[model samples]
Target: MKAEKNAVLTGAHFIDGDHAACEGAIAAGCKFVAGYPITPSTEVIERIALRFPLVGGVFIQMEDEIASSIAIQGAVWAGKKAMTVTSGPGFSLMMEHIGYAAITETPCVFINVQRSGPSTGLPTLPAQADMMQARWGSHGDYEVIAIVPNSPQECFDLTIRAFNLAEEYRVPVLVMMDECVGHMTEKVVIPEADQIDIVERKFTKKPPGEYKMFETNESMVPEMIKVGDGYRMHLTGLTHDERGYPAMSPKVQQKMLRRLVDKILLNEEKIRHIEEDEVEGADIVVISYGITSRVVLPAIKKAREDGLKVGHIRLLTVWPFPEAYIRDLAKRVSAFVVPELNLGQIVHEVERCAAGHAVTRLVPHAGGAVHEPVDIYDAIKGVLEHA
Candidate 1:
């Protein structure tokens, strides 16, 4: 399906990442949004509140993050694509419902415009600290797709991708943007409605009496029916069988959990998005994501100028971690240098995947700012000396 003509603001416009994300959601057929206004991310909902009504959509400023998170799920069951936006602190409040979304197979987007934090840290500053939290913050074992964007243009592009992935996988998809990207202004090209592809909801084709809410075949994703569609639906957070009713036994628990995790794990290659350059026989590969990906480019250029064999890999999709790809790359590279806004979050995933095949070094930062080019350069040179 294509975007609605009215929703696709078809032309080039100077916009910030927050506003671009709002336009992206609208372009992706998202008709309902429920979010609380939080720093760095508030502009997203603000634009949605203003623009949604014009597109026949609804934006509600919920009482809190908790309500906002679950409200989007309700909207999904009611037959509309939906989303919620927040920064780190509000993201923390939404974790439980995130788990609920996963277990119930609700397709929705969660935009976390990341800010510095373990608590209510610097709300206005950028941080990539939530990379780990987005995947592991919710309790229990479930999988989700997470994508990060470095620029306002990509902020628009990837948010549409996030919504598409959510509908395709029937999992909560996250658009992880940092404060710098969210607030930075850039020229964004909004293509025509026909140029934008949309993944419509997979509504069940079976008649009401023949439909089973959570039934699936080879795709590992079940067909969905809206709340008033004459189908009986019973979705719960507990372990369940093909039917969406609760089944508390261990066998049902194992089957339910495996399906939820395997659907993503099995289709990982299709979901993985990373950009690699000059990695062939390179001694050091710099791994980074989000704003840090943009920040580390100069360092990479400097390393190449200094006669060092260096390459770069920017993670466009952070969750699922691209474990197999990193494991393969580790076999050829001498070391991997990970630079993130957080002290050491994604670097651990690199180290684990490298698994002694190559040295994994972390150029850590404690948030509020990005790493200097010299810092990343020094790590690259240091890895060469040690390796």
Candidate 2:
């Protein structure tokens, strides 16, 4: 659906990443948000609690993150564009619901402003440790979209992109923000309502008695029908048929889970987004995402100045994890230096995709703060010295 004109904040404003994400949701036509306030991410729903009402939207502070996560899915089925906000601990609490959304194919968004954590480890600090958890937190086999934003502007832009993808794929999309990006303030330029591209829910064209809730076309994305629209639907976490009925057979299980994943795997080319630079003759490429992407740029430049040809790939979409791209690039590069806020989350993915073609180096940090670019530069230098 096109964004409501009144909800569009079409101008420049200096705001924190969390607040900008709130406005981004508004511009993307989100009418309902349910969140339980948590450190470093509270400002997102705090802004929503105030601003949502002004734009004919609603924000509910649920009893806890579990309630907050599931509440948004209920809103989605009621034909509202809905989302929930949280941090690391809350993200852990919401894993079950993320699975619910995935199995039910509910169109909703989860904004996790990540903090250092095994369990409330550092509530006010930033961490990218949840990258693997975001990909595989929920139980069962399922694929979900996760987007990473490095700057405040990207926090705004990518949040809208998160919603559009959730709508387009009929799956929960994760806005994986860390504490640094969420709390950092910057100038965010929001465009006019008309200029924004929105992907509305693909509602079923069938009449009341003709629709099958889980039936999908070639896209593997089924058309949705809101509750109270005179269409009967059965939804469960169990393996079900296209009509949404439970079938306990192994074959039914295979079919349901396959589509749950294939819808994303088949469209990897469209969903994957990566930014690359200076790779034609580079000996090593540095891969990073979210806030770490910005932190690594100076190191890349420094290495280049020292006559080390280092390329960069700032991952925009982290989940359908740019496998083919990395595999192809590994054929040319001698090694990959991965520096992230975590010890070594995504570096493993790069290693796996490199397929023994290139050396993979991990420059790890144990959260709370960003990486020093010199550390990254040293890693690049060491890799080249060995090569």
TM per candidate comes to 0.99, 0.99
| Candidate 1: Cα lDDT at 320 | 73
Q: Give the TM-score (vs. native) of candidate 2.
A: 0.99
Q: Give me the candidate number with maximum lDDT.
A: 1
The alpha-carbon lDDT assigned to residue 373 of candidate 1 equals: 83
Tell me the tens digit of each residue's lDDT in model 2 across 1-387: 566788889899999999999999988989999999899899999999999778989899999999999999999999999999999989999999999999999999999998998898999999999999999999989999999998889988999999999999999999999999999999999988888888999998899778888988898999999988888777888888988998999999999999999999888889998888887788899999999999999999998898888999999999988889899999998999999988899999999999999999999999999999999999999986675
Q: Tens-digit lDDT track for model 1 on 175-251?
A: 99999999999999999999999999999899987888888999999999999877868888888888788898999
Candidate 1, pairs of clashing residues: none
- Native-to-model Cα distance after best TM-score fit, residue 371 in candidate 1, in Å: 1.2
Residue 310 error for model 1, in Å? 0.8
- List the candidate 2 regions with Cα displacement exceeding 4 Å: none
